[model samples]
Target chain A: MKFGILVNEGPYTHEASDTAYQFTKAALEKGHEIVRVFFYHDGVNNGTRLTTPPQDERNIVKRWGELADQHKLDMVVCVAAAQRRGIVDTDEAKRHGKDADNIAPGFHISGLGQLIDAGIKADRLVVFGD
Target chain B: MLHTVNKSPFERNTLESCLRHAKKGSAVLLIEDGVYGALKGTTVSGKVSEAMKSVTVYALQPDIEARGVQNRVLDGIKLVDYGGFVDLVTEHNATQSWL
Candidate 1:
């Protein structure tokens, strides 16, 4: 089955990100297709490169990037939510005159239409939220 | 359809509201604080029990364990892992997240 994943909460502080990650990984392992992983609301915090955790702790931001790389996942952070939360890619940083970009690998800032499109294209839309 | 509730029944009426709209034969998944609704006894467990007559209720194992409520989970509410969560979504045609 094909799946559209919607994550609406931040990492570490909320369990939504962890659960979404686990679900996506399990789906892929089961030979299911992922249409897209859309991060909205505080979920965009999962895309920021600036996130760092203690050495023994699991780095949620980097973990998502690694998962995306291994699966070639289309991980999209909502532009409106990202902008509101200060999660910026290089282009967004340049467009907004920010000093630097903080978007992690495998994540692109996009509009909510991507989410709606995922809903239409994927067989199921699985939401992990607060 | 599958309905997911991620808020505590004590904190919000999301679980109640989701159960109210959830049709018979539908699946309801409780995650995060929403696992609180699966407890055997609570102020709102009666509503959950009533809804379970028609709706099949499930709770995420990790969330329930994380909150230390696994021991107190009500009977008949199946516990599922992440893989099981994927299976639930695949089984249902649509999912409504009650955030």
Candidate 2:
């Protein structure tokens, strides 16, 4: 089955985002296809390159990047959420008059329509939140 | 149908909102912090059960395991792994996630 994941919480606050990550990996291991991962609200924090967890903690940002790299996942962060959180790619950073771009590779900043598209395109839209 | 709720009962009527419109043969999946509501013998659990019946109720194994509530999960509620989680969505015609 093809799956679309909607993650709406930050990585550290709760296990929602992290659990989504683990679930994504497990889905791939089970030979299921992941159509896309859409990050909204605080979930967009997963796309920030500046995040650094403590040594004893899980580096959720890095883990997400690694998962994307290994699985060739399309990681999409909501543009509204990203802009509100000050996470932007090079073009968005330039447009917003920011000096630096913090959105990591393998992740793109897009609108909510992308999420709707994923929901319509994929066979399933699984969500992790709060 | 697949129903998802990540908000707590104390905050709002999340369970009601999540399941009130559920279709037949659907399941409710509690994830993230929402697993806290799956604890047996709680008012929250009772309310969840009361609001919806017959349909399967599930909580993420990892979330419940992380919170040390695996043993406390209600009898009728099933625990779902990630693969099973994917199956729930595939079985349903539509999915709704309530925050």
Identify the candidate with maximal TM-score.
1
Give the alpha carbon lDDT tens digit for every residue of B19-54 in model 2: 677665678898777787787777777776764575
Model 2 RMSD vs true structure: 2.2
lDDT of 2 at B35: 80
- Show where candidate 2 strays beyond 4 Å: B49-53
Evaluated with lDDT, which candidate comes out highest?
Answer: 1
lDDT of 1 by residue, A1-130 (tens): 8899999999998888988998999999999999999999999999998887999999998988998999899999999999999999999999999999999988999999999999999999888887
C-alpha positional error of residue A19 in candidate 1 after TM-score superposition, expressed in Å: 1.3
Task: Give me the displacement of residue A18 in model 2, in angstroms.
Answer: 1.6
Model 1 lDDT per residue over B73-99, tens place: 988999999889999888988889998
* Per-residue lDDT of model 2, residues A13-123, tens digit only: 877887788888888888888899999999998888888778998889888888899999999999998899888999998897999999887799989999999988888
Docking quality tier of model 2: medium
In model 2, residue pairs whose N, Cα or C atoms come closer than 3 Å (at least 3 residues apart or on different chains), thus clashing, are none
lDDT scores in order: 0.92, 0.83
Worst 10 residues of 1 chain A by lDDT: A121-130
The per-candidate TM-score of the B chain, in the order shown, comes to 0.98, 0.86
